[model samples]
Target: MIKAIVNVSLKAGVLDSQGKAVHHALDSLHFSGVSNVRVGKQIILELDTEDKTTAMADVTKMCEELLANTVIEDYEIELV
Candidate 1:
């Protein structure tokens, strides 16, 4: 079996509204020294295949197809 980890994040220059909201909330809570914030998502999948190369490819295709929005988001795939 193989474990695939997919990290999906917004591309640079894209406005991260959720991140901004979190930063604002932290400031309101008196949390100082907060510079910037970014929001992202991680997806973990357990595949039945043992081939690392094939697993990586499949996961990447999944990302390009339905997992991440290629226009505004970038994704990284890690196989373990």
Candidate 2:
């Protein structure tokens, strides 16, 4: 079996509203030293296949196709 770890995040040039909201909330709470904040999504999948290369490819495809929107986001995959 193989495990796939996927990270999805907004593109570098894109605006992250969620992160900005959290930053504002932090400031309202009197939390100092808070600079930039970014939000991301993580997904973990357990695969029945044992082949590392194939599993990685499949997971990457999944991320590209459904897990993330390439137009506004970038995704990374790690096989474990």
Top model number, lDDT: 1
Candidate 1 wrongly placed segments (more than 4 Å): none
Please, what are the lDDT tens digits per residue for candidate 1 over residues 20-69?
99999999999999999999999999999989989988998999999999
Clashes of each: 0, 0
Each model's TM-score, in the order given? 0.97, 0.94
For every candidate, C-alpha RMSD to the true structure in Å: 0.6, 0.8
Off by over 4 Å in 2: none
lDDT of 2 at 44: 95
Worst 10 residues of 1 by lDDT: 51-60
Candidate 2 structure, TM-score to reference: 0.94
Highest-scoring model, TM-score: 1
